[model samples]
Target: MSKTVRIPRRSRAGILAAIILGICLLLLLTVGVLTVGAADAHPPRLVDNAGLLSQAEADSLRATLDQYSEELNFDIVVVTTNTLDGKTPRDYADDYFDYNGYGYGANRDGALFLRYINGSSKEVWLSTSGEGIKAIRDADIESIFDDMEDDIRANRYGAAFQIFAQDVRDEVLDYRSYDTIWIFVGLAVGLGVGLIATNAMRSSLKSVRQQRYAGSYIKGNSVNITEARDIFLYRTVSRVAKPKESSGGGSSTHTSSSGRSHGGGGRSM
Candidate 1:
């Protein structure tokens, strides 16, 4: 006898693997969309500058911030405040960063006094840090703004704005890196939502299909039913055809096997 080789059939396993792979891909896609979607903060952050921007300027900046928001998926709030009279970084502990929520200064522990000017699509600044244009980190952004407070108070608005804008541009150029956990969470939430929705839809369709398949078959059957007969006495009908009648010169009579006769029989005399 010759031995024959058969490629062991693995079709079922292959199909199962394909289905799992498809589901995983779908889940990943959902996560990616959620991870990269726009964030909550658009232009005009600081939450306090709500009413300061003119309609035209606010509209333009809003558009710019909106673009950034979509890209970074984070909100960046902005605020502009005047310096307190006779205040300097050395005068007293500053609360500018404290009030703004950026956190207290990292190096100086004091607010820098500078002037703020205009902002564009990506940046907001007052002046150089005096040491160097240390990339516009959010923590330092606040200090830069506080530093400009003095220039603004002195009515050097143009110079103040130039420094502010320059720093902002640098900060944006150095977009911040985010925590990896947030990315994973975003993907998890998206995948969960997709799976739930897909399962619900599949369940509904399965029920409908079952109903359709069941409806295709028809039943044809017959059954024998039992019948009943009733019997009673006195004033009630006891037989199918029982009556009194005359036959010839006699009242109608009938004879049964037991020799019982009714009134419809003929008599001899």
Candidate 2:
């Protein structure tokens, strides 16, 4: 005979309570770690060192950048300065993005729009990283600058920054859409070539003539039909709209001062 040791009911309840508490604590710790990691992913997106924007305007622009960054899963930043610290527009923008830790993901996926105001001369540079390099092409960067050119000239800093943020979001989201347009264009060209070849083959067949009725296929008095009926079958029609032209040329990249590859363009205002 063997005697079995049983755990008391209160002890079992206490053990269950402790396990539940431990799980809750573990979940809290995990959430906290994730929060900290997210915060470290990208630094402050808007740095108006030149004081180009008012307090209210800065807040608004920052909010817009934050919103777009979250939606695109890529950092969008704006920086303004009175001087570039003796570096060229491109070098300054690239260095700012790299040294300030202002990007997301391992590859530092982000875009930094830098406005360097020196006296009356204004220069802007767009610096792209990781996925931003592919999403924003040279032509796309030019278009973005065009969109902000008028606003910036008019001293509408807030409006210009908003446009920059919106355009960046649009370009990133529609980057693959440009490729789709090319696919459509290729399909249309192939279809046209196919039709032309088929027409040429048909034209070469001189022995085949157009027949007005089914009776032309049968020999004279060889077959007679007692009754004839026409039945309707389903018909399918497919239509593809023509693809609109896209202005996306392609991304051009260069090695930044940090040895990291980047793609972008610059404009003078």
Best by TM-score: 2
Worst 10-residue stretch by lDDT in candidate 1? 260-269
Error of 1 at 155 (Å): 13
State TM-scores per candidate.
0.27, 0.65
- Model 2 pairs in collision: none
Candidate 2 stretches with Cα past 4 Å from truth are 1-27, 30-41, 103-107, 184-251
lDDT of 2: 0.91
Q: Root-mean-square deviation of each candidate, in angstroms?
A: 43.0, 12.6
Best by lDDT: 2
> What lDDT tens digits, residue by residue, belong to model 2 across residues 90-160?
99999999999877789999999999998877899999999899889898899999999999999999999
C-alpha lDDT (0 to 100) for residue 48 of candidate 1: 25
